[model samples]
Target: MIVAKQKPIEEIIEEVKDSKKLLILGCNECVTVCEAGGKKEVAVLASALRMYFMNKGQEITIDEHTLERQCDHEYLEEIRGNIDQYDAVLSLACGVGVQFMAEKYFNIPILPGVDTCFMGATEERGVWSERCQGCGKCVLAKTGGICPVSRCAKRLFNGPCGGSTKGHCEINKDVVCGWQLIIDRLKELGKLDDYETLAPIKDWSTERAGGPRKVVREDLQA
Candidate 1:
């Protein structure tokens, strides 16, 4: 899942301070699951913005709306009729959603309300940890289902690095060495011998390093 966090209220307030009317748009996708930009968060932010303006003896029209998703055209079209009523939109979705919204509504200013973090997993209700880097390649098969590319502090293709000690990353005692985890997992699967084989030089062009990437399934296209 893509994880993100809410931007500071002060920054958000500053983004729309000059607008007479605004829309606090929320998304019910990954941001919602992470508690950054969901329906409840939209209400909280909208109410806070109102309260801030009210204290200044200024009145502003702030409307709250949560979309099923802000990244898809079909879902975004739902707001086409009413979007123009607001001077600007304060999107509480991830950066992707905010950018997509801007693309869909060229004349309106679409402001981001959250900082997109990373593709990760929910370790607990409020804790999220990075799990994938979307490198456009898979090495899990040889690495015992662990990704040294993302989980390693050094993004090591083949290593526990000399910095690792006692199976913990040298950068931080709390972090388990990515290679150590791979070794342990491989051992459990009786595939420890696989470690003798070195990983090939990764083709980084397949990753974001090559620039924005896209995949198309010809059959899926309508």
Candidate 2:
């Protein structure tokens, strides 16, 4: 899942302070799972903004709206009727949703309310960790299902870097050595011999380094 963190209240206030009417938009997708930009968060932020302006002797029209997904055109279209009522939209979705809203509503100011983190999974209650880098290639089959690109401090593919000591990453003692985890998993699968087989030089062009990537599936499209 895509994880994100909310921006500070002060920064959010500053972004919409100049506007008389503000729309606090929330998304019910990944942000909801991360507890960053969901219906509940939208209400909290709207109330905070209202209180801030009220305390300043200002009267601002603050409204709250959450879409099933701001990233989808169908969901975003729900606001088409009254989108002009607000001076700007404070989107609590990820960066992608913010940009999508902007593109769909070219004249309106679509401001981001959260910083988009990486693709990750919940580690525990209130805790999340990075899992995949979307490298455009899958190596988990050869590496015992552990992602070296995202797990490794240096994105090493071969083996534990010299900097790793006792299965801990040199960057931080708390960080597990990605390669060490791979080795252990391979041993469990009786594929330890695969460790000696070197991974071919990675073609980074397949990643974001080349440009914005797109995958078109004619079968899935109308």
Candidate 3:
């Protein structure tokens, strides 16, 4: 899942305070799961902004809307007619959603209401930790399903660094050595022999090195 966090109210206030009318757009996807941008969050933020303006002896129109998703063209199209009524839209989705919204409505200002963090999983009720970097190539098969790209501090492809001590990462004692976890898993699976195999140099071009990435399934395309 993609993790995100709500921006400070003060920062959000600055983004749309000048507008006579604003729309607080929320998403019901990953941001909702993370409690950053959801139906409830949208209501809370909109109410806070309304209160802020009300205290100044001013009035502004702030509409609240929650979409099933802001990234998909089909979902975004739902607001095509209504979006123009607002001066600007504060999108409480991930960065991709905000950018996609802007691309769709080029003339309107689509502002981000949350800071997109990373692709991660919910560790507990309110804690989220990184899990995947979407490097284009997946190596979980050989690594015992643990992702070194996201878990390792250095994103090592071979093995743990010399600084690692007692299964702890060199960067921080609190962080477990990613390689250590991989090795242990491999051991449990009785596949320790795979560790002796030399890992080829990682092709970084498949990552951000080549710029924006895309996946198109020819068979899936209508």
Candidate 4:
């Protein structure tokens, strides 16, 4: 899932303070799972902003709205008729959703309310860990299931580097060496021999290094 963190309220207040009308928009997707932006968060932020403006003797129109997804054009269209009522929209979605809304409504300002973090897995409640880099290449079949790109300190593909000691990374004792995890998994699968195989130099152009990437499915297109 794409993880995100809500920006500080002080910073958010500064962004919409000058606007007479504000819309605290939320997305019920990835940001909602991370507890960053959702229906409840929208209400909470709306209340806080309302109180702040009330105390400052500024009566501004602030509305709260949440869509099933801010990234979908169909969902975003739900607000088109009423969108003109607000001066700006404080989108509580991930970076993609913020930009998606902006692209759909070029005439209105779409302000981001959360800091997009990364594509990751929820380690547990209130705890998340990065697991994928979306490199546009899948190497898990060759290196067990664990990802070395995001987990390894050095992103070593073949084996654990000299910096790894007893399955821990040199960067920090608490950090587990990603290569160690891969080797252990290989051993369990009786595929330890694959460890001796040398991987070719990675072609990084398939990753974000290539620039913004897009995938279009011809089968799904109209």
TM-score of 1: 0.97
Instruction: Assess every candidate by TM-score.
Output: 0.97, 0.97, 0.97, 0.96
Backbone clashes in model 4, listed as residue pairs: none
Whole-model Cα lDDT of every candidate shown, in order: 0.94, 0.94, 0.94, 0.92
Query: Given candidate 1, what's the lDDT at residue 158?
Result: 72
Q: Candidate 1 — which residues are off by over 4 angstroms? A: none
Tens-digit lDDT track of model 1 for 36-96: 9999999999999999999997879999999999999999999999999999999999999
Q: Write the per-residue lDDT of candidate 4 for residues 84-177, one digit (tens) a residue.
A: 8888999999999999999999988999999999999999999988899898897989898888888898888878889999999999999999
Candidate 3 error regions (>4 Å): none
Candidate 2 contains a number of clashing pairs equal to 0
**lDDT preference between candidates 1 and 4, better one:** 1
Off by over 4 Å in 4: none
Quote model 3's TM-score. Answer: 0.97
Distance from true position, residue 181, model 3, in Å?
0.9
